[model samples]
Target: MIEQLGPPTLFFTLSSANTKWPDLHKLFPKTQSNTVHHNRMQFIENLVNNPHITTLYLHLRFQIFRDEVIVKQLHATDHWYRYEWQHRGSAHIHGFLWLPQAPNIDNLDSSNHESIQSVKNLFDQYITTWNPRTEVDHLNKQYIPAISNPCLSNTGVISRSEPCTDYTELVNVVQCHMKCLEYTCLKKNSTLKCRYKAHWPEQHDSSLTLDHNNNPSYKPARNDSRLNVHNPMMLAIWRANVDCQAICSKKAILQYISKYVSKTEHKSESYIDILKRIVGLINSEDTILLAYHRFMMGIVADRDISTQETCHMLLKLPLISCTRQFVNLNVGKKIFQL
Candidate 1:
């Protein structure tokens, strides 16, 4: 990845449950035929086999480009990304985008006060965890809060799973739902609070943190604890769990991304052979020399997509193909035209 794209400037994750990809939610919809979804293995197999998940992943790839142009207005020069069929019945993606113009310690000829300010402005303008203050934003569902994770109340009673009663109170006090969820875990572990120290009463304060790795990471301030870090346009489109963060230390991020890349996968012998050939090609002297030349010349990386037999089966299904139109909200909106 470093050979193709310089260092990454942004790292983000997109999940299937948080996506608007067509036919994803209907893969095992509660119908007469699919009522026996309690079979965990079958359910996961179905999720892994669903082509809509891949379609969503492809759409999200484009959406990232769209976001760079329309929202951030910055050039996303190059990116390296990967996907995973999560065990919890959804598709997960991790993308590392290298924006040459981003102002940070990673970039050369930058990291000055003005450059830091510019980066900070971009962070503030793009990354936020607050409810929509405008009517347009509300109508667009711009400030979608994550479902409050269950927690123990102040009275030593377990928090309710059904209709939330003290939701407002807990949110007002804890600042973040994750913080609330950690209360019992902390007690069980005999710890004072969350190890990350993120559970404290929320503070809307921006910090220029220089860690042990000498990486300057930016954290934008937000007054409200209920909001998750996300862009309005991003949430509006994906509407699922979305995380956008500035890349601090390139080495640190490289290590983090490597973990995902090295994840063990269930594959056929043919798939394994294909991977081995690709690795050989990548390690070849000619390929390495050519890539180095391209890297030196500042050429960018490209994208690739492929499907397996499972995905092909789903794609070829008549019932699945017939329901593609139901996957998009915009398509549903225009249904009155009929």
Candidate 2:
């Protein structure tokens, strides 16, 4: 995972959840435009145009309690998928929650240290939760490397599972699916049931038009019945956000560590801290890198239909993220149509 991004990649987006105030992007823009999400539409538009990125998925997993799926968040994307192991009192944590980590392993970069934060947010919005120790302990303690071991914190008995393979597989699979879906759509007559709920030139979501002939202008991945959304790769992406995958990864590592150490001291700092140092230290004029970051982040913001089932033709990942997030919001708008 580290190699793919070149360094301990930072989820600058994730850091906002830890803030006491609302996310910086949502609150302010010009001054704190450094937020990866600022001008999300511009970023996404650029992502589609980017030549490096191909396919991508932002997976999120939710905590199921009492038969209710407590969405950590819908994460704005349905193509994201997930996997699970028998609850081992630990959970794997991946922004990309593709798989689990190993014991005696210290992957500080991919730390799933949300020690029982909140699950309710998953039901409504994308939020992070943790059953934290005191602020000092939470802020001061170093996050242990995510090697397999015993459950470190008691957020839950479930342990984070180790990642079985690189999550780039998710991108690969999604790209494949999109390709197939696109083919089928061209050859066959199928659409999001042929319609657009997208707002007007001016109209409420319900007021939008429907194309009974499946002749709608654009097809959303979640609505495309031709493409299977429940595949393994997609599940990996969604799990990163909703499930305990990140938790599971840490759990495995904690368990592994327990086997070797009795009174091991939790480090005084964690990978999260290290990322902050780097992100904070970087100059604003690092324009090329920042541009790339914005490009990828826009892709991550991409979301699909609300329906769980989909069969739409597969779409290719933008080698370079150039599609603006705003396009996704207006996917059904006839304004883009001739």
Best by TM-score: 1
Clashes of 1: 2
How would you encode candidate 2's per-residue C-alpha lDDT over 263-291 as one tens digit per residue?
33333334455445446544677676764
Superposed model 1: Cα runs more than 4 Å off: 1-5, 18-75, 107-112, 133-197, 261-338
Return the lDDT, model 2, position 171. 20
Per-residue lDDT, model 1, residue 60, is 47
Give the RMSD in angstroms, all C-alphas superposed, for model 2.
Answer: 26.2
Q: Which ten residues in a row have the lowest lDDT in candidate 2?
A: 9-18
Please give, for residues 155-255, the per-residue lDDT of candidate 1 as tens digits.
Answer: 12322322233332223222233443321234335555644445324555665566666667677676554455554445444434566776656676867
Q: What TM-score, computed on C-alpha atoms, does each candidate reach? A: 0.49, 0.18
Q: Lowest summed lDDT over 10 consecutive residues: which window, candidate 1?
A: 317-326
Error of 1 at 306 (Å): 18
- Local error of candidate 1 at 151, Å? 24
